[model samples]
Target chain A: MTIQRRAAFGVAAALPFAGARGQAAQTIRIGVLNDQSGPYRDISGPSGVQCALQAVAEFGSRGFNVEVINADHQNRPDVGVNIARQWYDQGVDMIIDVPTSSVGLAVNNVAREKNKAYINTGSATSDLTGAQCSPNTIHWMYDTYMLAKSTGAAMVRAGGDTWFFITADYAFGHALERDTGNFVRGAGGRVLGSVRYPFPATTDFSSFLVQAQASRAKVIGFANAGADTINSIKQAAEFGVTRRGTKLAALLMFLPDVHSIGLETAQGLVLTESFYWDLNARTRAFTDRMRPRLRDVVPNMASAANYSATLHYLKAIADMGVAASKASGIDVINRMKAMPCDDDAFGAGTIRLDGRKLCPAYLFEVKAPAESRGRWDYYKLVQTTPAEEAFRPIGEGGCALVRS
Target chain B: MDLFGIPAPLLFGQVLLGLINGAFYALLSLGLAVIFGMLNVINFTHGAQFMMGAFVAWMLLEWLGIGYWGALLLAPLIVGATGIIMERLMIARLYKLDHLYGLLLTFGLGLIIEGLFRNEFGSSGLPYRIPVELQGAWDLDFMFMPVYRGWVVLVAFVMCLATWLVIEKTKIGSYLRAATENPALVQAFGINVPRMMTLTYGAGVALAAFAGVLAAPIYSVNPQMGSNLIIIVFAVVVIGGMGSILGSVLTGFGLGIIEGLTKVFYPEASSTVIFVVMALVLLARPAALLGRS
Candidate 1:
């Protein structure tokens, strides 16, 4: 049969099977699945949906009719898996931007098993590109290894040696600690000691701060995020640990954390990230476009990843003529693998079939009290971690996709 | 592997860390218990109130030049006064209703407070410096402790004990308890029950704010600060029965110590061990380790 004839036949046969009854199957159905209304709500809710819409608008003119569906996974692996399943079962071409790493990884498993494309933007586990790496998943943003390696090794080499970790006690924290420890040891620095505070630990980090102070480590690395990172740093200051010449290195701080801690406390802290608001002219332009959309929360790496990944997913669907051909999950995914994604976050990056999306990361120094002219005037670019050496060594990651 | 069969420094340090976490848990759970005792209401907003206290203190220092000492006394009073207004206006009506309504109302209040704070200050924490006097670390042979952290633990413990004493031993506490048990009788006996209820809520909320002030120096002051800790406190309250003041305090401190020890022995289970213990406790006796049946 001719390609055109076969494609027409496939659509005719798949029409009755599509989720939308009587509606034309010409529109590309993409699921912008994320944690919308739970713990991760503020991080990846309506803004994620808007990101998907922007992608659809940008990719629509290039021969794709896009439809986006947003859902709150509530940080539950089961919920995220179910959402992906439902979207796939209901004829969604791809699932994009599942944020919580556990949930994102779970969705990737479902997508791979079901033969659908899962464009991961929210998760930060290196496993998505390593042992747990799936042919069907793409970890588009920062991972623990990338974050730790960039900040830990570089900072230690720059004389911020002797480390104390104030870690959030969980899988993420463990991963961060392990990766950062590797970086520190590799950089000829000694890890003094560490303390693990429970997840959602109450307001007092006095004890952890005390432990960090007692270590007298030059750098107190906070391998935590959200309020936990904020609190630990705050308490460290209160105990005068920082003033006593102990510098802080927040391994995974978001812009929101900087804003919350205010300029005074957040100043002079060196950290690393894949993206920053005022990094370059391109980034500034991107943030300018995303500002009205994000409202208060500045476009962090996660949001940027979401925007870029969603755009790339739609472009892949259009390129393969998946919607018109009524292609199954694996067909759509294979097509996505063939396309190159060039976006504002990573400039120009290709999706590796093994799911490792390579990107450059930057080391940022929180501006000193004197350096800051005003509020939001927080970080100054110190150095950029070259993309090649920014992430975990492929062989060491244990990702099945990497060949020995 | 070093000196003793176990590393003495490691053991000592872990113990110190345990004591420190225990102090925070005791202070937070103690505040929760006080709120529950008199208001008969689980102030879901307690964590938010705590966050507010820290923010208020930070603001006092930043905007008004009110130092740590001034904020320590003034911040809680400001929060307490707000609580009084909240008690008189909204919480007073729900006294006769199911406790769940109070929880829901307080939860709504928490959302509002968190949203406002997030909008105003953003999510990053504002650092509150420790006073110069408490800046240094004290060396013990085994493990060095920061002077400020040691002070936090001591002060929180004292505060917890004082609150327990005031509620369990004082004349005002006696009248407060009577009003809680039999409002009509207490009113007939010339004690204004409404005023007592309002004051109780005010006091209960004040404790939460007090904990906040104590925490401000340790944790960066942020909007979502209370939300994160609040859930854990809820779990703490559930594990410790909200009924008895002493039970809550003991359970809070005890669980924190257990959690710290778990980190040393079995690192993986450290985060989840508390919940696991809570589950086991629930299975053995549903009223919690120290909860009243």
Candidate 2:
């Protein structure tokens, strides 16, 4: 070979090496921000980040690299927004598992402004895809609308026509109560009244329970989540509210809350969710893979949704190639909407144009102590709403993305 | 059936519920009053210690097969010992500084303790079953009352009264009172004021923990349990004035009943009723309801 040809070969080899180095430097960073040390910690704290990492592992990182980082939003919107802004400036492509509605909404706005993707699996507010819908945000898992509809409509159908709510005083609680009340009224039930308790502060629900009892409502719907939900249910049992012919409806409940309240007291309480660990073979397999990493706590719907959403988000990135980085969050989200999402956790689902992930929502009754077979075996599925009917219709949400 | 436009049964039921809440308020505030009146140091870790008490009960049951009755006797001791160690290692060092320093130091300690527990056990609560003997309710014709709840109120009242008598009527309490007035003189007169201070702090923590053990059956045994009650206890201390033990006890129960009545008449203000009363008390008397200027 001529000396000039040998030199050309050397330059060509070094050019590929330089390109690989640049690609390596652009590792896709996914941030998981949620309550890590507060009341919501058990619901979606460090376990949420673990689920994301598991997704990254299962996705194989493809030809590129992926990294998962997390922070404790401490259930504060300002704290969540600051962390999101910092992560976005640091080149984080997506943020996930924001549980609290207040914090989730704040982070959603930040994602929109920063043009970064946000996959929310923790929050329950339908407003995410409603008036506050963002092109950069995709709300996965369940929402208040689904929860109220499944639990409320089912309860009303089962002879609970009069309702009173002991609600947690917050945006999440108000949305839950409003949505559930609408469903109840729509099903020919009447809402007697509702009393709001200070969130994360009121430990004693005896007074609230007494008032609920006096309302003469057959169904006392608890429109709250986390420890507040557990406390209200336990106190109601102790007061024998259920024994005295009043049904306690938990509008929003997690597996951990059921575990905390125990099957004995929590039994017969109706709740709604998009995922349960022991649902089927696929969900069981997914839970089996993630259980060892979860420190014995079964993956709640939020954490399970984290795994599914992260897997799908990675798939979308893989489909978009290296240009995924240059593409705006809306572009990636639009691509995600264009693709069908099929995963072990949620089975077959789709991301609607309004950014609401459509999937089946299950109405579950807490199992009696005699009915539970093993650890974390708490839920008994009563009914399942199909994907098309599970969430609010895309056109009904009034999203600017859908309108346009 | 209507009493002033409200159902008579509802009125009575809420009052019973309020009395139960007041019992807890009185118990916790009395402990805070005792410690503040004696130590001149605000133990911010009182809530964490209370949480520790509940966890100790849970641990005893889970680890050693101890029941709730055994836990009722042992959890407070374990929690008291923890307080003594905390007092010796961290809180005692801040006694020479401003009272705010003591507050800040204990507050940091509280955060550490609470964080450690939260890390060990996630924030979701654990169930503590009521004893089989106390599982039923009392049908008083006027209203139904859970047997366990009624027991809690009676025991709490007895505990608060006993604490008051010991502090106001016993020889050691007089020594404690004297030490609070002039520690240097008490130290010079052959009494170990520092040691008394440590014991007093531990006892106060034990009192809070005792309340926690009592609470475990009613409230879920969780890391943030003490934190939820501590703020209300602080408000109770302010309204009752940290200077008077009896005043703290009475105000705790009084405001509890008032809060219950508020729930019946105006459900919206139940949570803030105590704080609102605190503000009014501060406006009328800056030192507190019974606090000395």
In candidate 1, which residue ranges exceed 4 Å CA deviation? A1-24, A36-49, A57-60, A159-169, A182-221, A238-249, A322-326, A329-333, A392-404, B1-20, B56-78, B81-147, B150-171, B227-293
**Residue lDDT tens for model 2, A263-339:** 88888888888899899999999999997788677788888889999999998888987466545888888889999
Computed on alpha carbons, the lDDT of every model, listed in order, comes to 0.74, 0.86
Best by TM-score: 2
List TM-score per model, in order: 0.81, 0.95
At residue B239, candidate 1 shows an lDDT of 81
Write down the C-alpha DockQ for each prediction.
Answer: 0.30, 0.62
Candidate 1, residues A1-404, lDDT tens digits: the string is 11222342344346447666545566666677765444344455666666666666655566545666667676788877876776677576677888767787788889887777778887777778877887677788688999888888877877977998877776677778888988898888999998776665444565566556666689888887766777667666655676667788888877666766666677778777787777778878877777776665567777677788877776666676745335566565556667776877567766565666777888888887788876556789888877767777667777776673
The Cα RMSD across the true interface for model 2 is 1.3
Fraction of true A-B contacts recovered by candidate 1: 0.38
Native contacts conserved, per model: 0.38, 0.68
Give the DockQ of candidate 1: 0.30
Kindly report, for each predicted structure in the order presented, the TM-score of its chain A compared with the true chain A: 0.88, 0.93
